[model samples]
Target: MNKKREIQSSVKDESLIEKRRAQMIRGAVTLFKQKGFHRTTTREIAKAAGFSIGTLYEYIRTKEDVLYLVCDSIYDEVHARLESLDIEKGSLEVLVTALEHYYGLIDDMQDEFVVMYQESKSLPKDALQYVLKKELEMVALFERLLTECRESGELKMTPKEIKLAAHHLFVQGQMWAFRRWALRDFTISEFIQTQTNFLLQGMAGEKISTQGAK
Candidate 1:
């Protein structure tokens, strides 16, 4: 995915700009979750951020800019966290760990994510495209991980299988968040356990039980 777009700012200190925008994103996520994008106003975002309306405007030009920043920050956070995983071994155990890690991260950000999915349609066309591109990059992460497993002989997928499986894994992780209310009966641990087992059984071509997953 492309690097974050340079939002014009009056502030000169790059570090300060990042710091303020981070605050704005945090504040905006809260409001978006509570009141949604259409109902939330820039003044409310400024108040939630513990800053003045004028200061908020110093970093972003519009409320839409704040929304774009929130979506951008979320994808960046997910990418950074996934990059921190040590999954190079490419074993079944490593694969299970990676899935669990990803699903857990998704659960952790369920609200912001749901907001992103629901409100991103309001984003400008170019901003929406950038967000969608970031999503493909996430899918690529899973594909690369699966490729590693295949090379190590822990998986038996063809290239097409690897690509589709990667999309499956990525979307399924988000499914847990997007369908949280319908799945309230299942704990995160149970959800992860069942999904991991289901995925591994298909990918490994054998029933590899993760009995200890719960």
Candidate 2:
């Protein structure tokens, strides 16, 4: 009975630690997004997280460490979402649906995504490389999806064209997050529908409509 109680106590402590870590990450993401990484300080992050500077240091070594943590978490979430998508069936429809889901996920993680996008270059060499590697993996995932679409005859672009198109498509998605203040007036479903139609019609070798219709 004593051993069982001790085990329960340990589990509770671990859960509390995870809760605190998540809170810190959430706070750090907001600060980093609002004030860019260079402008934000560890002390600010600590205060925002409702913890002392010393306690913040106990969990994260520096402001950069917090950036890395936030980015890693964001990327992990994206990778998980991508992994669950069924890219093998109805490749074009799957890609459209996956992209819509991707946009929603990134929108939900807007703070972290924005911070990482804007401030990853400020990291030290090794840390910047680590972040870029994760970003490249994401890029490759999209490229693969584009390639599958082209091979499946769902898209008419050549390999080189597909790669370029994928890059542009990604940039368009990023614009939705980066320009959310201006885009906030537009709903996510509207943005997804508009963007998806734009990409699909263009990739299908059709001319883009000026009035935003396919």
Clashing pairs in 2: none
Please provide, for model 2 over 107-177, each residue's C-alpha lDDT reduced to its tens digit, 9 standing for 90 to 100.
78877778888887777677777767776677767788888877887777777887787677766887777
All models, RMSD in angstroms: 2.2, 7.3
- Please provide TM-scores, in order, for all candidate models, with all chains considered together: 0.89, 0.82
lDDT of each: 0.86, 0.72
Pick the lDDT winner.
1
lDDT of 1 by residue, 114-141 (tens): 8899899999988899999998998888
Q: Lowest lDDT 10-mer window, candidate 2? A: 1-10
Q: Model 1's lDDT to the true fold?
A: 0.86
**What shift in Å separates residue 182 of candidate 2 from its native position after superposition?**
1.9
